[model samples]
Target: MADTAFHSARQRYADLGVDVDAALSRLAGISISLHCWQGDDVTGFESSSQSLGGGIAVTGSYPGKARNPAELREDLDKALSLIPGSHRLNLHASYGEFGGVKVDRDQIDVSHFAGWIDWARSRRMGLDFNPTFFSHPLAADGFTIAHSDDGIRGFWVRHGQICRKIGAAMGAALGSPTVTNVWIPDGYKDTPVDRLAPRRRLEDSLDRIFAEPLSPAHNLDAVEPKLFGLGSESYVVGSHEFYLGYAIRRGKLMCLDAGHYHPTETIADKLTSVLMSVDRVLLHVSRGVRWDSDHVVTLNEELLAISHELVRNDLLGRVHIGMDYFDASINRVAAWVIGARNVLKSLLIALLEPTERLRQVELNRDLTARLAILEECKSLPWGAVWDEYCRRQSTPVGQSWLDEVRAYEQLVLSKR
Candidate 1:
């Protein structure tokens, strides 16, 4: 019955000038990076008592959260087992395996992340990295790179530098370039009198961090900007405009996070413009309910639009897609699988669209036909195609994956 449904769906899509097989093939090639922080609510093993500062907050205390590298990896392995296709792992510098040794952010090196590299290697997964700029004593004031004090600014800069090297090492080990994204929680709660000074400091600090160049094959650098954070409601130092200009000028990958902007603003429309200026782009896919809450991603309108734009513009190869959300209210591994599968589902739907026909209609200035076709496309048998894709990948189709998650919770997470 599943195969019969897929065959009919394929014929329907083919009638509309879409190739279901080709779409599924392309979807399999796309790898979404899963964030490791989601397993532990961004609570890295650096210090058990470390407070989650710098405008970051995780609500709801869900049990079975991973307390160490072993548990985190175990949970991650379980989540990846349910998720279809090849995927990468995204790690924060704070999540490095220190083996009970105290390694400050500035002093962290490739040795700390050697365990992670081996883990990824064993699973044949690529790894992405981020610098730990928040949840530390130095960042208590809600500033790091843009700090008024030079010594504090230097500390974060050194941290970023070391993180890049560690990212390079992981890429080398996995034979895939690792994207090391730099995002700082540098802003103020209230309106600042001198915003220019802090931005200047941030620009200089970023320049220093990226000064030591590494091979592009080993590592790719990206800068992420946020509109506002919890405490930095009044002003966020690394605003979108700042990083857009910096990325274009410096030839760096500009990371456009979905939840970093206003609720009404979507990164979907910005894809074409950014790709024209920058060589590459990185996306941190997340859902923001009225703010940058980092809720688990769903197959919502914005996510679908993002997927459509990427497919339409042929930007998938030039873009690095990664999931960035932490919802501690539910089973952590379930959240990972849900967000990842939703992202892949969106991409599959986008790929299955009759883009060429739509383009032809637009070229003829037939807006009516274009709109009609788009609306009709939504009601197509994309779900059948997705189930087929999941079956081909040997992952659970439909809600069956949830059972596995629940079973894991009973056997593994419950013990925690």
Candidate 2:
């Protein structure tokens, strides 16, 4: 019955000049990098006790949060098994395994992440990295890489330098380029008297951090921007304009996090414009409720629009997609599965869009026809095709995945 439904849906799409099989094929190739912090509520396995700060907070006291690297990996394995496509793991410098020894952010080396590399290698998955700029004593004032103190700023610069090398090493070992992104929480709680000095220091710090040239195949660098956060409500140093101009001038990937903009603004529209100046982009797909709350992603209109822009403009090759949400209110592993599956679902729907036909209508000044086709596509049988995709991938075909998660919770998470 499922096969029959898919076949009927395939023909329905075929009539509209859309290729179902091709869409599925392309989706299979796209990998969304899942953040590891979601599993443990951002409490990394560091010997030093650093409270979660830096203008961001994780809510909910969900039970069974992974306590250590082993448990985190175990939880990640279960979540990965449930998700439908191949994906990469995004790691923070703070997550490095330090065998009962204290390894500060600046002192972190690839040796610290050797276990992670082997783990990723065994799973045949690539790794992406971020320099942890928060939750440390040095970053307590909500400033890193842009601190007024030279020593504090240099410490973060060294951290960034070492992180890029670690990212490059992971990429070279795994035969995939690792995108090492930099996002700082530097800003003022109250409006600063002089904003110009901090930005100048930040630019200089970034220049020194990225001074060493590395192969793009091994490691790609990206700079992320934000609108505001808890502590830095008045001012944020790394605004979108700052990073956009820097990315353009430095020839690096610009990371446009979905939740890093105003509630009314969406990163979907920024894709085409950013791509004109930068060669590549790194997207942190997230959902923000009024602020950067980091809610789990769902099949929302903004998500659909993002996928549509990627597919319509044919920008998949140039854009590296990654999930960036942490909702610990529900089951932690389930949050991962839900957000990842929805991201893939949005991409699949966009893939099934008859973009060229709509483009032809719009180019020919047929606005009515264009709008009609767009509205008509909403009622298309995309769900049947999604089920077929799940079946073909040997993943659970729908809400059946929820059952597996429930079983895991009862058997595994409950004990933890």
**1-416 per-residue lDDT for model 1 (tens digits):** 99999999999999998988989999999999999999999999997787698878998799999999999999999999999999999999999888888888999999888889999999999999999999999999999999989899999999999999999998999999999999999998999999899999999999999999899999999999998998899999999999999999999999999999899899999999999999999999999998655999999999999999999999999999999999999999999999999999999999999999999999999999999999999999999999999999999999999999999999999998
Tell me, by lDDT, which candidate is best.
Answer: 1
- Kindly list the per-residue Cα lDDT of model 2 for residues 289-382, writing each as its tens digit: 9866489999999999999999999999999999888877899999999999999999999999999899999999999999999999999999
> Which parts of model 2 have CA positions greater than 4 angstroms off?
none
Pairs of colliding residues, candidate 1: none
Clashes of 1: 0
Query: Ten residues in a row with the worst lDDT in model 1?
Result: 47-56
Cα lDDT, all candidates = 0.94, 0.93
Q: TM-scores, in order shown?
A: 0.99, 0.99
